[model samples]
Structure formats: C-alpha cells, structure tokens
Target: MRREITGFSNPTVKLLKSLRDKKHRKREGLFLAEGLRLLTDARACGRLPQMLVMATARDPHPLLDALEADVLASGGEVIVTSADILSKITGKDNPQGVAGVFAEFDTSLDRLDRSSAKIWLVAQALRDPGNLGTMLRTGDAVGAGGLILIDDCADPFSVEAVRASMGAVFTQGLAQAGWDDFLTWLRAGEGQLVAASLREAVPYRGAPYAAPCFVMVGNESRGLPEDYELACDLRVTMPMKGRADSLNAAVAAAVLAYEVLASLEG
Candidate 1:
C-alpha cells in the first residue's frame, strides 16, 4: 500500500525537509535526489533509496513507473503526497514531482585499486556546485578512479550539483578530504599530482600522464593557492593560441581527464 502524506507539518515530511540542510543531512547520513533520472541512476549504481516520494497527481511519469516498481521490489517505501507538501519538503518552487532519500555511500580512496592507473580530479576550494558536478560527470565519463574534493568545496549532493551532474553524481565515487588527508593519500599511492595553471610553460599534452596521477583544479575565481604550486609534481597548462585567458574549471578538468584517458589507451 502506498502511504499518503497530506501536510508539510507531518513529522515525516518535516524530517524530509530537514535533509535540505547540510548539517541535518550529515547527521542523518542521507541525501535527497530529485527527478526521475537521478533516482534511476542511483538504483543502477546499487544505491537503494530508503524512501521514495512523489506528487500524487504526477503518478504516471513513464520513467518513474519503473523506478517505483523497482523501489517496491527492493523493500523500499513509496509515499504519495500533494505538490504543496513536496514543494515544502524540497524547498523548490517546482518540485521535480519525484524525490528520494538515499543512504550516503562512504567513499574512501583506500577502496580504489591502486594497481590500475588511478586518476582523480581534486577540486580545491571550488564553491560552485555546478562546476563540481560538471567535474564529477566528466570524471566518470573518462573512467577516473574517483573525485577528491579538498577543503571548502561545495556539497556534491546538493540539488544544484545533482542537476548539474545530470545523474552522474550517484554513479561516481567521491571522497571529501582536507589538504592533509589528500596529501596522505598521494604519498600512500605514490601518485603524481598535476596542478592546472594558466602560467605554466609545459603543456598538459607533454606531461607523464601514463603514471598513476591526480589532477588538481582550483577555485573558479582565484586560481590555486601558493602552497599548491610547490605541492604539485607537475604544473601543466592548456595550449590556447586564441585570446581566452583560460578555460572554465570544469572544461579544464575534462580536457585533462581525456588527455589522461588517451595516454592510457595508446
């Protein structure tokens, strides 16, 4: 039987709304995934959402039917609620008509296979969720080992991030670590760190990318910190004969990721 929730004031609905806050999400060890595609991707990635919520009026969204059936088979609960309640729960003007709460996967760099040509895209102080999500999607596309988010990076599970990733967030492994933690991992793997910079004389194409490595992209506005200049094993720049100063952080990451992939395949 599908449970019906009428009011946003209901305790269950209230708890769902709390998930919008980072602290609450952390405390509960879960995050919200909105829309049909994200929910589908989550399941495909072996992430079973604990609860599925859908607006009662929007029942037959074709993509959602399979998801609902799959959730039911997986011993998950499906709730039907009004649009008003969904909006309040999601804090979105137009709720995607579907949303779900999924258990957060504990992703650690230690889980990765070090014997492979492990590649990670580390975002340092990247404040924009969209940029972070784009990087995640690109990372997954290029078969990156995982993403390592450094200090002060945006929450990869946020609504903006999920939307920007277009469902790649759930498919990719992610590790959020501070500078020291990343440094520790780098040392453990003996992986080379290549920092992207506009001032570099060495083009990324010429770098020794065949080895196990992690590429670092800095903040959207300010580039990498002064200390990162010394930390990186190699500093690389993209060739641009045109007038553009630099590529966007996400674009730069995609270029570097594909370059690494090409090197591995060749």
Candidate 2:
C-alpha cells in the first residue's frame, strides 16, 4: 500500500527535512536526492532509494510514475504528499515534486591505490556546492580516479551539490581529508601536483599530462593557499584572453580535466 503524507508536519516529511544537515545524514547514513534526473541516475547506478516521495497531484509527471514503479519493484517505500510539504521539506521555493532518501555510498580515500590511479582532482576550500557538484560531474566525465576535498570545503552530498551534479555524486569516489593528510597522500603517490594559478609561467596545456598525476584547484574567491603552493610540482595557468581574469572554479576544473584526458589519449 502507498503511504500518503498530507502535511509538512508529517513525521516522514520532518525526517526528510532533517537530511539537510550533515550530522543527520552522517548519523543516518543516508542522503536526500531531489529532482527526476538525480533520482533516475541513482536508480540507474543501482543505488536504489530507501524512500520515494511524490507530490499528490492529478496527472503527475510521467517520470515520477516511472520512478514510483521502479522504486516499488525494487522493494522500496513510496510516499505521496502535498506540494507544500515537499517545499517545506526541501526548503526550495520550487520543488520538483519528487525527492528520495538514499543510502550514502562509501567515499574512502584509503581505498585508492596510487599505482593504478590516473588523474585526481583536489579541491581546497571550494565553498560553493554548485561548483563542487559541477566539478564532480566533470570529473566523472573525464574518468578521474577520484576527488579529494580538503578542509572547510562544501559538503558534496548536500542537496544543492547533488542536484547540480545530476547524480554524478553517487557514482564518483569522493573523500574528505585535512591539509596535512592531503599533502601526505600527494607525497606518497609522488604524482605531479599541478596547481592552477593565475601567476604561473607554465600554461595548463603545456603541463605534463602523464598518468598518476594530481591537479589541485583552489577556492572560488581566493586562489591556491600560500603553503600549498610550495607543495606543487608545477603551477599551471589557464590562458585568459577575455576581460575576465579567471574562470569559474568548475569551468576551470573541467578545462584542465579534459586537457589531461586529451593528453593521455594522444
């Protein structure tokens, strides 16, 4: 039988809303996914959702119907609720009428072995969830080995980040480490640490795109950290011909990741 939750005050609705916090997600070992695309991707990846919530409306979205069937077939619970309830749960002015709670996938950096790894993207203090999500999607596209977020970075599992990633978050290997831990890993791997810097003499295209390398991109407003620069084997810059002195953090990461891929392909 399908469960119908009518109000924002519903117990299920409150639980979904609590997933917005990292602590709750950590304690429960679950995260919320919003929108059809993200939920679809999660299903496609075999990360079946624990619960599916849909807005109670006539002529519901076709995709939602498909998702409901899929979730039910997979032995998951489904709930129908009001649009107001969904908005309050997601804290979004415009709710997509569908959301899901899924088990958080493993994201351990220790599982990555430097011997077989090719390219890795390290984000230091990337505070924008959207940018982090885009980076993760692009990283998946470029077949990056994994992503490492240094201290004080945005939570990649956040709803906004997961939405922006379009479900890439579920597929990618992500790990959070402190600055010292990151440095230790980079040193142990002995991989090229290519820092993206505006003042660098070497252009991004000129940097060696050899296997088993790591590229570090810094925060949105601030560039690379001063101490981190000393750890970089090479500092590479993206050529800027336009009026803008720099590109967005996600755009910069994609440009560099693809370049590395192209170089490896050659």
Candidate 3:
C-alpha cells in the first residue's frame, strides 16, 4: 500500500527527517539513503527498504517503477510527498526525488566471510563519512569482499556516507568492531593484516600480498598507533616525493588496495 505525506508538521515527516541524525537512526534501527540509483543498487543487492519516500512529480522510470513495485510486493509502504519535504528529510537544498529507509545490517565481525575475497579494507578511527564511503567505493572497485571498520569509525549507514559510496555501501559487506576484537577475529582465521607504515616498512608495490589480505589505514589526523602497526603481518609505505607528506586515509586505502589487487591477481 502507498501513502501520501503532504504536511511538514506530520509526525512521519518529522521521523523521516530525524534520520539525518545518528541518534534517531540508532533509536529507529533504520537509516536513510537518498537517490534512485542507490535504491536500485540496494534492490539489486537483494535488499528492499521498509519505507520509500518519493517526490510527487518524479519523472517516470522503469527502474523506479520496478523498485516501487518490489517494495509493495514485499509488504512495504511508499509515501509520495513534495520535493520540498524530500529536501527537508535529506537536509539537501536540491534533494534527490527519492529516498529509502533500510534497516541496518549485522555488523559483527563474525558476520564477515573473510575468505570470500582476496583483499579487505580496514580503517581505525576514521571520522569522515565521506572518507568511509570512499573506502567502501574503493573496496568495491578492488573487488574486496567487504570493509572492516576498527574502532570509532564513522557510521557506515549515514546518509552522507551512503551518498558518497555511490551504492558501494549496498554492494560491500561492512563490519564494525573494536581493535582487539578484530585482531582476535583475524587471528582465528587465515587472514593477513597489512598496513601502511614508515617503521622499517617495505614499499607498497609488489609486496607479498596474499588472499584475504587486510589493507589497513589509520585515523585521518593521528595515523595508526604503534601497537596497531606492530600487530600487522606486514607494514608497507607509499612514497611521498612531493610537498605532501601523506595521502588521505581513503586515497591511501584505494592505492594500497589496487596494488594488493595487482599483486594477488598477477
């Protein structure tokens, strides 16, 4: 069944808009993702949003039609509202015509199947939603099975990160865990923990990267702690010849991911 939400004062509107904040999302156990492409990607990934919000004048499309149909067929609800309301919900001046509310996934370390792919991306204290999303995008690009966030990372389901991921959030498996828990989990499996480092590290290129190699990056500002680096099976460094001393956390992951990809694929 479908519904229409026309008033800004509507409690549904308020709840939908509240999803823009982490607290509301945590309370509701739902996160919002805007844009038709992201919704379509979610659908393709065998996920259907529990609630779909669409603008009243949205242009017709087969994909959107398919999405709406699937949502209804699966006993989900659709709300048709004005573009301005969509803007309010998304906190965007020019909101995408559609948004979806999906339940957060199981993000425990045990839910991750490490042996499924050759490379995995891990971030420690990554604070930026955009960077987190970019890491997910990089994971998708490198054909990694998933992204494992270790300690105090950005919320993977935040709208900004979801938007930045460009649908990689839906495609990539995501797990969040404390550093010690993650290390314990990794040790229990046949996985290699690798990170970018400067303390007696090898060049990132052509390293002895193996299947299930975890390419780890540290906090955007603080870098990795000494103990964290020491725990890694390998520590490789990227060259910084120019004035820039280091790469962005997400960029570093992408570069290291690609190198690891080449090494394992070769």
**Best prediction by lDDT:** 3
Query: How far off is residue 184 in model 1, in Å?
Result: 1.8
lDDT by residue for model 1 over 44-72, one digit each (tens)? Answer: 88776789999988858766887888888
Candidate 3 structure quality by residue, lDDT tens digits, 162-212 = 989999999999999999999999999899999999988999987888888
Measured with C-alpha atoms, the lDDT of residue 127 in candidate 2 is 97
* TM-score (C-alpha, index-matched) for candidate 2: 0.87
> How do all models score by TM-score?
0.89, 0.87, 0.99
Weakest ten-residue segment in model 1 by summed lDDT:
109-118
TM-score of 1: 0.89
Name the weakest run of 10 consecutive residues (lDDT summed) in model 2.
Answer: 192-201
Better of 2 and 3 by TM-score: 3
* TM-score for candidate 3, residues paired by index: 0.99
**Scored by CA lDDT, what does every candidate get?**
0.82, 0.82, 0.93
Q: In candidate 1, residue 146 scores what lDDT?
A: 68
